[model samples]
Target: MTGTVTCEPGTPGVPGTVGTSGTPGAPGTPVVRRNRRATRPAPAGVDPRPSQHALTSRASEDRPEGWGDASASKQVSSYDAELQRDKPPHWG
Candidate 1:
């Protein structure tokens, strides 16, 4: 016979091996894993995550007084902040 060498067909790649889109992994159904974290009770009379609408009067309650309306996106700098305490003289 003439010199013609033909090898077996190459094995097919996994489903999601090529291209720019589609799910991660082998391109099949997704598998959801379980979360091992355990929930615990917080402070008393405080509903950390209130389920009812009346629980939180306004979602922006944590925001500063002037940080409302169009000014919400502006960067805020506090000039009279008191939480910072004076450090002891050592590296001076």
Candidate 2:
């Protein structure tokens, strides 16, 4: 005889066919378990760190105006100037 076992969501247990000894089937079968973590609030005075977006915005505000755009343009222009400088005079 052949049979299939199924489990429901959020149910923590193993699903398998019952053997002749009245015990669950082989240990190779998969089992579902609950996450036993504490959900209690933090201790009295601790503060969670700032979130990623908040930290990023704070860093951006600390930078000089137009710093990102200016840096990117400077990189491109410097690369182009270097390439031009390396070329033979006759190739210009």
Candidate 3:
């Protein structure tokens, strides 16, 4: 009689295959190309910009340079990905 075996989902490689060693796209294979740039260190004295979460949080806030939350100032617009909650229609 014949039997069957199954490997766990998180198995490193194919259950019944041998692992091969060598660089990707060996001599006989085509070269791989990507549009990514290499990362480098930044200079001193300059501060890093705020992250997307921080920037979005500050932007969505209804407060302005010289305005208050309830000053009828616009916060966000209905066309934006995230709408300002509890604000007037003219705000966003």
Candidate 4:
């Protein structure tokens, strides 16, 4: 995202003939200045936060299709088991 300040044309200063003359009016087109934020990609070893749906999918990847028969507690344990056994420390 960027923040931009644009200068709009308004009344010009009174024309000066004595002493230091006032600067001329701005050009016909407005002046545009953009303040852009610096954006950098995450490092290779770092992991982005996963969505809830993604977490659920990874947790259940090893389960059978009709896993509804399993008790809720069993399902949770299986999911944790899969993550523990399959994922390395750096994965997260």
lDDT of each: 0.43, 0.49, 0.42, 0.47
- Residue-by-residue lDDT tens digits, candidate 2, 1-92: 13544333333444444432334453334333446667876676854443433433445645554464444335457777797789998896
Candidate closest to the true structure, highest TM-score: 4
After TM-score superposition, the amount by which residue 61's alpha carbon in candidate 4 deviates from its true location, in angstroms, is 21
Which runs in model 2 stand beyond 4 Å of their true positions?
1-29, 43-49, 56-92
User: For candidate 1, lDDT tens digit of each residue in 1-92?
Assistant: 23322222231443333322343332343323446579988799987777653643545755565364335565544532321234345634
Q: Worst lDDT window (10 residues) for model 3?
A: 16-25
How many angstroms is residue 82 displaced in model 4 relative to the true structure, after the best TM-score fit?
31
Which candidate's lDDT is highest? 2
Clashing pairs in 2: none
Off by over 4 Å in 3: 1-28, 34-39, 52-92
* Residue 45 in candidate 3, Cα distance off native in Å: 2.1
Name the lDDT of candidate 4.
Answer: 0.47
How do the residues 2-56 of candidate 3 rate in per-residue lDDT, one tens digit apiece? 2333333333543322222243332332234444668766568744553533443
Q: Is candidate 2 or candidate 3 better by lDDT?
A: 2
Better of 2 and 3 by TM-score: 2
